[model samples]
Target: MIRFEGIHKSYPVHGREVVALHPLDLTIQAGEVFGIVGHSGAGKSTLLRLINGLETPSGGTLTVDGQALGTLDGDGLRRLRRRVGMIFQHFNLLSARTVLDNIAFPLRLAGVSKAQARARAQDLLVRVGLEAHRDKYPAQLSGGQKQRVGVARALATEPKILLCDEATSALDPQTTASVLQLLDGINRELGLTIVLITHEMDVVRRVCDRVAVLDAGHLVESGPVAEVFLHPQHPTTRRFVAESEAIDEGALQEDIAHVAGRLLRLTFTGEDTWQPLLGRVARETGIDYTILAGRIDRIKRLPYGQLTLAVTGAQSDEALRRFAQAGVHVEELSR
Candidate 1:
């Protein structure tokens, strides 16, 4: 488990200290995919660096798997880092090394014999589906293939925690999905704790079990992905969600300005998301409904749908109640 107790960070810039992160408390349970999201310079990279002792906290304490980061010495920090692996946004492969050598570098550094290191590297190479390119150099591979090598190298040490510093931001959308799938599979199969930082909520929705939203060096919001994505509490989080869903709230409101009846945003989850709940409710309540906008998506493994609708007739309230009874979350937007 990882825990932060009033953690904060600052940097010295030409005779003055500049705060990079505000004090915040957060805990990530073991074997879960935790995501930290923010735009550029929101201290996300700083926070992730603190986990592996690459950056020191200016105040407070950070504990990873029971080791206090602030108290660790050079050797102690090295040992702690061995238990935590990291993947960079750019596939930081050694230009001079083959894929297999890149994967074996850490083991070699740890004094493993050349034969043992290469054998372990071979296993990781196959695990990441890069055995065919094990002898190839980074320059010879595509962007996605280079990242696969990075992932394999990070896992070669059998670390308990994996830190991904915007690991997919540099890849195309299709490649991003494939890398995310690989990360998800690794988390489930090896029970490794994965913490990734990204600016995209869609990335979090696809793989993160829980997420924290950072804005201008502050932790603006944090929760389970389903909760944060469906019902954002903070403005920063809501904007992120809107961007992820490609929603223009003002435009949507303008489009519905002249529409009559009650405006409601209905949220459905689990089996309810797949069921024809809206049609059935309209039929049962004898109300007319028009869907203004809607989307069906998944958060991690849970399916969900959100619909904005205008409902009319005397039984509209009854329809709302029926929706609630059917395990749907009903938010009355306007009436």
Candidate 2:
């Protein structure tokens, strides 16, 4: 587990102290895929770097797996790094080395013999499905293949925590999905605690169990992915979700301006998403509804559906009550 108690960071820029992170408290539970999401310069990278002692906090305490970071000496920090592996957005492979050699580099640094390091590298190459590219150099491989090699190299140290610093931002959408699937598989199989930082909410929706939203160095919001994604409370978070879903709230409101009925936004999750409750309720209560906008998608492993509807008839209030009773989240929207 990783715990941050009023942790904050600052840097000396142009002869003055500049705050990069505000004092905040957060906890990332063990074996869960946690995401730190924000726009550029929002301190996402700063927070991730603090977990492995790459950046020391200016205030408060940071503990990883019960070990305090501030007390660690040079050797202790080295030991901590051995247990925390990091992959970069740009594949930071050794230019002159083969994929096999690159993966074995970390082990060699840790005093493992050449034969033993290569042997471990061989196992990682197979795990990342890069066995065929083992002898190839970074320049000779495709972007996805290079990242696979990066994953293998980061795993070479057998770290308990994997830090992905925008690991998929450099890839195409198809390749991004492929790499995310690989990360998800690794998490499930090895129970590794993965913390990834990205600007994309779609990435969080696909893999993160929980997420923290950062804006202007402040920790604005944090919660389970399903909860935060579906119902955002902060402006920064809402903007990210809107961008991810390609939603134009102003346009949507304008589109519904002329519609005549009570506006409602209904949210359904899990098995409720599969239920035909809308039609059944309409029939029973004689309420008519027109879907103004709707979306059905999966957040991590849970399937969810959200719809904006123009509901009418004298039974509208009863229909809303029935929806709430059936475990559906009903929010009234205004024009």
Candidate 3:
């Protein structure tokens, strides 16, 4: 429901124009959780702002729900923005207002009657599991609680799209997981199309259906999360995956080189049990195999499995061919 075509943004610094986003072309489908990941200067945040009209592009087009952003005037932009909600790294709540009042503030600004706004806020408090904390002030609540208030406030107007700019960056790991789970529930229940921008790859892996990797203000890669994780094409994408898997590249390379037989990295997904394939390879090829480092996890409720194995003797190639026939991806590692 959102599209950017050849978008570019530049700012003048010390009389030199610095490009923040470079000719970005992207599409975010309706009801999908899309993630943008990059380092600090990669312009991920700027890209989000462009969608909400907070930052106008220097060139190219941005459209949401088929309306070109470039054509919107102040009133049009304001009306368009009402349908888009945003939450920031900081909770950005009004400290003086209680949790209930903080959430009602947005609705009230939209000309909703005080009683109606309070009713809506109360409902949201319950939805976000903050019913008991409605009377608490920002200082009286924890970081996660404060963010919940922010989330409730953002949803007060029932926006179709939510832009999360490092929304969980300030919280601890446990709290982050809780907040991410809440977001996931919101997306599933409300069909809210979410755009999450963060440096954390785990966040994308956990909640995002599709992800885009940006570097030096340019789009490096974009695709389904599982596909990207399994077969990363860009160097930056590989680094992100490696970091998430905690792979010791230097040590892995050394080990692969020392192996006396063929080394292969095998990847499997959904319903394709590794045990059967391993059994078949061993029984058919007579190649001794040793399992190295790898992992298995669930992605979108589907089994995702990876294994690194060493196969001895000339039978290694035959075994790998069998694995391929069995629908397993085998990537040969350099010796």
Candidate 4:
């Protein structure tokens, strides 16, 4: 339940104004896991800060749940911020505070009674699977555990929306997966709306329901994760998806040329089935197929498949046309 219309934010740099966010307009619905992705200096972080009033916009309107954030003063914004929680990459916990106390800190700020806060903290510790480590300090906990404490603390206030600023970036791959799973669980169970910003497409692929691509302070693309992954429009979006696929374009091209065959890359989504298409192509067309690389995975709980094939036959064009007629995308690689 957030809307940003014609939002702009700029700063003075080297005696000239630099735009960090260039009049972006976006809407995030309630109970949705939305992702903002881009490289560094893409203003993704800046956009998140604007939502929480950490950075005021230079022009235009920002509304949260129908309330205009731009009109709110310091005290009003403070009150509104309680309904929004944020988690950081570095697991920003007070090192001196124990795990339980760290979670309790937010409740304390909100003037939650000690006994009530303790009960809430205990429940959160248990929720995050950190009940046994409640007495341990931040330094004693592992990176994942520390981040769990951060999550517990962020949830302490029972915020409706959670802002994750590269929450999994600092963790190892295994730990990152664990943390992402936790976020997914929270969103499903609590119906909490989560807005996550990260450079990793894998993270978005695993957890995000919808994603928005930002580049040069502009909103380039936004849609369901599966749709965006299957048909990326922007250059940056295509690059991210290609990199995530780990496609070796140069090598694939060389192999295709040397083999004196056409290289076709096909993507299959939920509506289309890959096995039937592969079978039909083999049975109908006399072309022999060499599958160089391929993968099938889930995005937002939907099947997404990709295949790279080298076809050797005089009827290669016919085979490609068959695939296209069957609604499969066929991209031919250059030599």
Candidate 5:
């Protein structure tokens, strides 16, 4: 587990201290995949480094597994880093080293005997499904395979935590999905605590249990991925959510300008998604509704749907009431 209490970071820029991260109070639960999402310069990458002590904080404290990072000496910090592994955006691998030796590098650095390290690395190769590529250099492998090697190397130490700094950002969409699935498997099997920073909301939706939205160094929103994705509160959070859903607010508004009736956005999750709520409500309330835009999707296995609809006639108000009574979140939109 990791906890940050009023933690903030700064650096000197032209002899003036510029804040890179705002005061943060967050707790990443044990064995859960936590994600920090933000655009470039939003401080998410800085937050990830802060977790493993790659970046020192200017104020407050960060504790990982009961060890206060600020209190650690150089040797203490090195020891603690062995318990936390990190993977990078570019698949940081020694170009000259074969996949086998690259994976064994971390273990060797930890004072593991060459033979033992090679054996452990060989086993990780199998675990990450890169056994066939063990003898190949980084240059010979595909992007996905290269990232797998990076993952294998990160796991060489068998750390309790894994820090992924845009580990899949460089990969294509399909490759990203495969790599994320691998991470999900690692979390489920080994129960490793994963802290990843990414600009892609799909990454969080696919694997993260909880997520925090950062903007201009501020923690704009933090909560279960499903909640934040469904009902984003902050402006930055909303933009991220909208971008993920590919919803162009301006375009949608223009498209609906001529539409009649009261516009409402309905959100439903889990079993509610399977129920014939729309048909049932329409029948019961005698309300005619038109779905303007919507989609059914999953948020880390939780089924959910958000439908932008138009409702007309007298029963529209009662229909909205029934939707609320059935636990569907409704938000009114302009005509």
Candidate 6:
């Protein structure tokens, strides 16, 4: 578990001070996968670094699993880091070491005997499905393989917390999916609290339980991933969600400019998504419907639907009322 109270960070630039992170208050529950998303220079990396004491906060305090980060001394910080492992976007492995040795490196640094380290590394290799590549060097393995080694190494310590800094950003889509699956498995099996930083909302949708959005070092939004993804409130959060769905609200409005009737955006979640709400409402009200833009999909394990429609006929208002009665979220785009 981690908690941030009025935590802020800044750096001196010439005679002036530049803030990288505004005072932020956040909580990351134990055994939950929490994600931080923002654009470049948004201080996402800075926030991640602060968790591990890599960057000292300029003000306020950070409490990680009951340890106050600001109170830790050099040795205390080092000990804390050993219990909080981190993986990088760029696989930072020793090129001279083989995959087996690369994974064993952290264990060895932690004072494990070479034999014990190698044995632990061997187990991690199989866990990550990279046992067959253990004898290969960093250069000899594929991008995915190298990241697996990085993941294996990060898990070598069996830390209570795992920090993923764009862990899948460098991989292709397929590879990214596979790596994300691996992270999810680790979270489920080990109950490791994961804090990952990424610009991709898709990553958050697939793996994170909760997410926080940042803009210019300011915390814009934070909540359960489904709530934030489904009904984004902040401008930055809305932009991220819209971009992830590849639907521009302005463009959608323009496209439906000539369409008749009230334009409504209906959102359905869980079993509400599966019910024949649309057909039932249409038939009951004799409202003719024209589908515009929409999608039926799952967010994490929960099914959801978002439909933009043109509803007409004399009973159109009644159709809208029926949609709400069926537990559908309706937004009047045009009426």
Best candidate (score: lDDT): 2
Tens digits of per-residue lDDT for model 1 on 78-150? 9999999999988888999999999999999999999999999999988889889989999999999999999
TM-score of 4: 0.93
In angstroms, the error of model 4 at 275 is 3.1
Candidate 6 Cα misplacement greater than 4 A, ranges: none
Predicted candidate 4 versus true structure: per-residue lDDT over 44-139, tens digit per residue: 999999989999899999998678997888899988889899999999899888899889998998899999999999999999999999899988
**lDDT tens readout by residue for model 6, 1-335:** 99999999999999899999999999999999999999999999999999999999999989998999988999999899998989999999999999999999999998999999999999999999999998889999889989999999999988999999999999999999899999999999999999999999989999999999999999999999999998899999988988888998887877798689888889999999988889988988999988989998877778899998988899988888888888899888743
Model 6, residue 84: displacement in angstroms? 0.8
Checking candidate 3 for backbone clashes, the offending pairs are: none
Please provide, for model 5 over 109-131, each residue's C-alpha lDDT reduced to its tens digit, 9 standing for 90 to 100: 88999999999999999999999
The worst-scoring run of ten residues by lDDT in candidate 1 lies at 326-335
Model 6 clash count equals 0
Q: What range of 10 consecutive residues in model 5 has the weakest lDDT sum?
A: 251-260
Estimate, for each residue in 1-335, the C-alpha lDDT of model 3 and write its tens digit: 99999999999999999999989789999999999999899999999999899999999989997799999889999988889999989989898999999999988998999999999999999999999998989999999999999899999999999999999999999999899999999999999999999988888888899999999998999999999888899999988888888899889877777667777889988889436788777888888977877888866556779888888866888888888988998898776
After superposing candidate 5 on the true structure, give the runs of residues whose Cα lies further than 4 Å from its correct spot: none
RMSD of each: 1.0, 0.9, 1.4, 2.0, 1.0, 1.2
The Cα error of candidate 2 at residue 53, in Å, is: 1.1
Query: Which of the two candidates, 2 or 5, achieves a greater lDDT against the reference?
Result: 2
The per-model lDDT (C-alpha) reads: 0.93, 0.95, 0.91, 0.89, 0.93, 0.93
Write down the TM-score for model 5.
0.98
Per-residue accuracy of model 2 over 1-335 as CA lDDT, tens digit each: 89999999999999999999999999999999999999999999999999999899999999998899999999999999999999999999999999999999999999999999999999999999989888988999989999999998999999999999999999999999999999999999999999999999999999999999999899999999999999999999999999998989888888798788999999999999999999999999999988978899999889999999999999999999999999999999877
By lDDT, the better pick of 3 and 6 is 6
